[model samples]
Target: MAYKSRIVQIFIFIITNFFLLLIIDSASSQNILTIESRSDPATPEDCSNRWIHIRNLPSRFNLDLLTNCSDYPLFDDFCPYLANHGLGQKTHIRSRSWYRTDPLLLELIFHRRILEYPCLTDDPDVANAVFLPYYAAIDSLRYLYGPDVNSSFQHGMDLFQFLRSDEPGIWERNMGHDHFLVMARPAWDFSQPLNNDPPVWGTSFLELPEFYNITALVPEGRPWPLQEHAVPYPTSFHPQNLTYFEAWIQRVKRSRRTSLMLFAGGGGIGSAPNIRRSIRNECENGTIKNNISSSSSFNIVQRNGVYSKLCHIVDCSNGICEHDPIRYMKPMLQATFCLQPPGDTPTRRSTFDAITAGCIPVFFEELSAKTQYGWHLPADKFAEFSVFIPKEEVVFKGLRILDVLMGIPRSEVRRMRQSIVELIPRVMYRRHGSSLELRSKKDAFDIAIDGALQTIKDKLGDTLEH
Candidate 1:
């Protein structure tokens, strides 16, 4: 009887230990699951796992342009704009992210950003896209002023040959379909005809058949989209982080707007459109036609008095506005609508500047904003944030621009302004050395990269299906 009792006691001890082990194992698994849940969340739309392989092009393609920056005729001293990895000189104000940025340095800015991209792979075989850090804009500037039009084609041709000979495997993989480069100038600058008498205004770099398959990201793209796609023009304000970005948005929202309209560009210049000259004429002469109602037919309204009360005009005829942000940005910040007329190109950098200031841009041409920046700005939702008046109606039909603006209902104005405020981040370029926290908020650079990658992916998918 004693032996049987001892056996039962041992059996009970073994059963209890087994049950304890089972509970411990189950608790460990639950803890692991909790940790995993905290670490991994749903993937963000802006975030990508696609790998980019940055091409190791010869120095002449990129760095050489910076070394000889002073020789560029466009700027008196172009070297200063080459600082901070193409961010230009810092404003030097404490806690302020303002820079004297050159609008044509997008190539340098993009190169720096891609160098620090998280998904960059050294192996071309594993890369989903190839990034060519070629300073095409700066390179073309040298040829713009020279009498030799044929020389414009040399640099681009050399770049093509180098890629074909050095990286034949990568270049031939998709026939350059997976590769991309940023050209800060307008697409037309690179698409000059080879058969012009006095040498056309731009280079023949983009007209090359070898480059037809390669994607070109430009500040101003062609009217009909092809290999060229539009990207945002660089603005002065580049927030350091998400905190600064959000703060600026709130400040713009809370600030009181005293003026109804603002125009910060040139008027009397030879290149200025008649519509721009007319707007300037109206603003400077303080012409306000009170007899005309919003419902009035498109008839000429005689110039009157006190137009300056509603519209603030910064005559950028002296070219001060481009170098001095305070001259134009302040007016834009204080105005409800910023007039964006077609400048040298169908688009102007001022459109982006207004967007950054949280000022609702009023475009006079469809190519200025609607069709140009579809990658950055929503094409279908233009009405929510912007106002468009056909240049033809304003120039030909004698439509009163001021009266039309004043007629927008206050509620609609508020909603439009609010929409513009929300769009601030989409049009901006974050400062270099931005934290991963800041990068999580997709800015212009991120959007451009994502668009380029998606283009390549779609093309590759189509090829595979065929």
Candidate 2:
């Protein structure tokens, strides 16, 4: 009789547990947010017609602006994102210390399922799969006013919150307004150990997009095609600010007592010795004149009766970029042309510094030409605003780089200086000085800034008082 009782009890327990398991599974399945791709055309006329409010874009906060170039190998037009994976379902978008947004919205690009939630995902295809190109306006004023609002990114808890949900194995494929496949991930954020060594949080994401000027984007680059994938690269054009433009204008107002001043920094890694030699040699030559160069190594060359390296740094933590934020302001305040070259790529901060300091920049890099529509900068409209050394010419024993600087006539040089000067207030020059004079390359950068600014002015353009 006892044995019979034991068997009956086992049967009852098994039945009860089976029913409970079914209930739990059903409850867990309720209302899960699923993300999937939307059927939208690549180019829509209305895309650029409006301004968007970005809470924070991964691209804005992750990539290093000084080192980033549009033509760099990583800048897309070559990444299919999810197609290379052997299994179509295992699409993992890659992000590094440079790109943070790519992993936030991976599911939306696949179109395999629907996003049932209002957030982002860690999957690359799901994160960057679907995003809107928004005219960016960062909240710099808020940060500036707060002074202590160092918000914690908490090891990208914010990103993981949006990209990777809390529960494991519970991913949804859906697109949200914050979906964007950023090219890189920033290692740093406001949260830090406070005693941790370099690589410091947010090196790649140093400047937040919420703190900068961004305008106009379109859908052009997608991660996947319409039928199979949804990850699209951003096709919306963004206009750049003309940092060199204002420098040119500022030069027109300066006195004649100034000599040339050039300060070059960005040491250790990006700072190459030969490139530094090239810059110093040009400045020191009598034929290639420069007033000053802030040197980090060796001495600033003395050419054409001008000084170089009024400032120098062997190694500095914060001091590397501090001294004269404006590359040529102190020297060019009295001089004419600033000896500027492309830093690794033609898109470094030097381009903005020289132009904004009222000094003309001489482009000596092959990449400089690429910045001008990936064609010859001499033939481009920007050619009217800056100077370039023709790549095909040779003036030295064989053909030295310095010879190119000497070969240009004074008349043509003067014209470009003046044109750049006139464009300053309209482009790079800002009354505050914090928001102007940047990569004087991209027409999109220039156009977007102007268009967005004009939009604001249009609101004020009304001859009325609120």
Candidate 3:
């Protein structure tokens, strides 16, 4: 009895010490660097030997841009976008709303994450990649919508001036090939051609010769890839920890699926109708039956004065969606397949949101899912998890989307749902809530950073040792 008691006491001591060591180690790491605005400029020695060196561009590049949120008349429309960060002031948490239609929040969230990333170093010397945290999409929103071409061009112009300056000496560092930028908008928005054609919507920042080598991380990349890499758009479901993610996955797996398929978007119209037009027609024609019904007309005019139709959006005319995030997610959870037609661009964040809800996505365009998320999603598992019916077959040939989805076996659908559930962790970003201190093995941010590093290594061809 004495011997056993002593052994138990020793075991307790060792366990307690192990946790104590962990706490001390965590404290030491926190003390290593403070993630805040700094005045010090990055030197050659600071970047020469780091894995990732974030350029300490003036606050104007990020926060200052958001400082004039009041200037925009639709400032109240930005509550959800600014809830996580202080868009201007820390507003009250009125409701659990996830009306993230405008992807400007993606850049804001990413900026917060990279600052807190463990790989982030104060020194620039040992860096394999340089991150230029610029909120180009957010800044140009007003100009893109208005007739202020010079105002829209001003943000890009300022970025160019800073990049070309001798202060940071970023020009000499790998000729900007190793440098990367993240824009929440589609690639086309930044690369509007300066030809004799009618003016484009977005800033022509990307068309500049100086930016040719820079890696662009965007929500939608063009088919013929230059440097633009498609990253997942910000979805409403930001789990605070792995437990919430795992619980949601289990809930989705066991939940009763009463619907065969669901489409949570509005109808479209016009001469050059997108795939959504066919989807709306099919739904109205009783070809596709939605478990939950919504009705509206969202007219979205694209660049060059073309009318693009959109729907399934909660009324944003009042600046905010009245519905809760769960309302958007419930249909997806109850359905076997979620219809994912392009929205404004070829890719929508709904594709990722469907994956999170454990629903198999039926993509109209291959680039919507197949080519976009190469970093986190496995190429081989595309067929195993998703369904792709080309837009031509749907719109031109009058292909029946419901017939194709119903043809897929129940067992196959179950397998695909399980596959999607398994991908929940990799695709979702962890929220900086209570579990911010508790680390995840890896998440979307880590996957993107690792992908960026590997891509640089491949392109540089042995120049980078990291």
For model 2, the local distance difference test gives 0.32
Q: Over the stretch 1-466, how does candidate 1's per-residue lDDT look in tens digits?
A: 9778656545543453354234323322322222211222333332354777788776678765665665656545465566566676666657367888888788888876665565655678878999887889888877885445457665488888999999699999998989999999999999876656566678988888899888899999988767899999999888877788888888788766777789888754455447787677656654345665533322222133212247788888856777678778777888889999886778999999998888889999899989988888999999999999887887778876787887788899999998998788788999866755777788899899889999888878877898
| Each model's Cα RMSD | 18.2, 21.5, 13.8
Could you tell which candidate, 1 or 3, scores higher by lDDT? Answer: 1
Q: Please, what is the TM-score per model?
A: 0.84, 0.38, 0.77
User: Per-residue alpha-carbon lDDT of model 3 for 1-466, expressed as tens digits?
Assistant: 9778656545543453354234323323533244332223355564343367677666567665664443565333443245444221212254222333345667766766665555555445556788887887777766675436644444477787887784455556677878887888888888776552556577777777778777888888888878888888766665555566567777888866655566665445555656877876666563323333323111111232321322122222232322244555776777777888876677877788788888788888887868888888877789888898998998899787866875677788878887888787787666543254324456777688778877776666645653
User: Best candidate, lDDT-wise?
Assistant: 1
- Give candidate 1's TM-score: 0.84
Candidate 3: where are CA atoms >4 Å away? 1-32, 35-50, 73-76, 86-102, 150-155, 196-198, 269-274, 287-324, 433-438, 462-466
- Candidate with best TM-score: 1
Selected candidate, larger TM-score, 2 vs 3: 3
List the lowest-lDDT window of 10 residues for candidate 3. 296-305
Candidate 3 similarity to native, TM-score: 0.77
Q: How accurate is candidate 1 locally (lDDT)?
A: 0.76
